[model samples]
Target: MEYITLNNGIKMPIVGTGTNTYGKENKDYNGALTNEIPELVTALELGYRSIDAAISYRNEELVGGILAESSVPREELFITTKIPAREEYVSSKESTRAAIDNSLKNFQTDYLDLLLIHAPIEDKEQLKNTWKVFEEYYEAGKLKAIGVSNFRKNHLDELKEFAKVKPAVNQIQINLKEKNEDLLALLQDEGITPVAWGPMKTEAHQQELLDEIGKAYDKSGAQVLLKYQIQRGVVVIPKSHNRANQAANLDLFDFELTAADVEKIENL
Candidate 1:
């Protein structure tokens, strides 16, 4: 896997596993929130050093549980977690500190590789307050780098006007179906790399487009979809409790999706 250097000089994996499920952490490890059987272990063993998560998922403890049990050294792993919205985080600024402290405690770590402000598109001041803690954390050497999630250009603009430290990344919904070239270009110009959550969009609205491209590559629709995003320099985090799909995502490094094949799948 390739790595993207954040503006702060932290090296982050260009690809990783996303853990987002809405359920109690006490369920079966595979039940979005329940199943922890072997998927987390599989991802680490597969050379995916980065793990993206958020508090809203209610799986941070499980994710942390898995990491603690793994042989992967904490230094070698790039673990990223987010502060949920204000109410959950409590108060934007103060909550970020408490949330991060809890994350470290739950994960059984002293510091985090990265931290992000989860979606707060409506409250601009609260967002800035949340970011202030991120800045403080970085300054304190508790977090290596900081960024945002599900943010649009306008939201970014609002951040820039108040932020002293520019975000290192913007995790968003980007895929073959929703190719926001305008936003991508804007982010590139600002030096913030775009990381995609649902990059293939096979679960969203790109199934038909993925189907067409799948035939050309002799690959599954999901494969073609992921390949297209990679070609555009978007970092993809495709999650699956299925070990086969997790392994399949790592195999993408070898194949080359032709330019014509990519154009054919554009925004369909």
Candidate 2:
């Protein structure tokens, strides 16, 4: 798998699997919070080393169970979780500290590869206070890297004003249809890694172009779209419950997109 070095000098897999069930009616599947454990096992078995999880997903314990049972060593896997941007946690220092502890306990892991603020809260001071706690954990080695998610340029600028440690990554919704080029450029300027959460989501009109591109590479339309984002230096965590789909997502490094192909996708 390909990797990207964060500003903090830690390498992260450019492609990972996101554990989130947004539209499912049944939140619990096979006794887990969601269909996380089985699918996670499938992903890991398929050579997916990075797992993106969050407190809001409510499946950390199940994921931990799968990790414990898997043959893959702890050091081989990159685990990431997040803190909710609610008042109970973000507004208080002690609660924020507990949140990290809780996640470690839930995951049954000593240290997280990465941690992020799930989203930017309305209160800037509260968010800053929470980030300060993250800095403390990062210094203490509980968290290998710290970052934020769903943050706009202004939110990042606000944090930068008082931040002692700059954010290593900014997780956002970046897909074939929603490019968000300006924000991506801003992240590049700040030396922050831009992680795409929904990297495979494409509109109907754009699928034909992606399919045509994929035909040349003997890849699927989704693979073509993922390659496009990866070429632009974006980290992607595409979620799928199917093992075949998971394997297909990781099978992207074999082919290279030409400058002309990249430009065509960028213009779409």
Candidate 3:
């Protein structure tokens, strides 16, 4: 697996499995419907080492259930989870500690490879509060790296100016249908790793984005999507329930997309 170092100096795999189906639980996504906890184990067994989960997904424990039973050494996996919603903690440190405590418990691990604030950042005061806690965890050896999801350039900037530790990763939506260059530039400037979600255009109107890219690369839509993201130095963790899709998603190491080909697909 290819990996990139976060700003805080943690090496994270460029491609990982995202578990965000919504229908089975309170969330509005697909993972809830699939309830494919076995797939988590399957992915690990298949040789993919990174797993991204979130509290709101309500499957951390299920995932942990697998981790507890599996033999993928605690050090070999890059496990990440998120804080679902804003909690009224007295201090950011308190919030960070409590969340990590719960997450480690959920994942059945002793530490986190990466922890991200799972929503678009809103205000300076709130971010300061949160980053404070994130830093505390990092110093205490509970979290290896810290970042946010759904944050745009503006949000990244505000937090950056006051941040004690630069964000190690920013999880956002980036794919053929929507390539946010400004977002990409902003992230690249600080060496803040960009972790892309929905690299395959989930729920997008351009369902065939993959098919088109697939034809060019002689690969599946999923493989092409993941390839594009990694080519741009962005980490992507797309979710799939079908075993074939799971295998196809990670089968991207063999091929290379040219500059001309990349532009053609990037514009699509």
Q: How does model 2 fare in lDDT?
A: 0.88
- Give per-residue CA lDDT, model 2, range 136-170, as digits (tens): 99999989999999999989989988999999999
Which candidate number would show the highest TM-score if scored against the true structure?
A: 2
- Per-residue lDDT for 56-171 in model 3, tens only? 77778777777778888889889889885465432356775677788889888788898898885465676787888888888899888888888887787688688888888888
Cα lDDT of candidate 3 equals 0.78
Which whole-number lDDT from 0 to 100 does residue 243 have in model 2? Answer: 80
TM-score of each: 0.87, 0.95, 0.88
List CA RMSD, all candidates.
Answer: 3.0, 2.3, 3.0
- The residue pairs that clash in candidate 3, if any, are 21-30, 21-31, 21-32, 22-29, 22-30, 22-31, 23-29, 24-32, 24-33
> How many clashes show up in model 1?
8
lDDT-based ranking, best first? 2, 1, 3
Give the runs in model 1 whose Cα sits over 4 Å from its true position. Answer: 22-37, 88-92, 203-218
lDDT of 1: 0.78
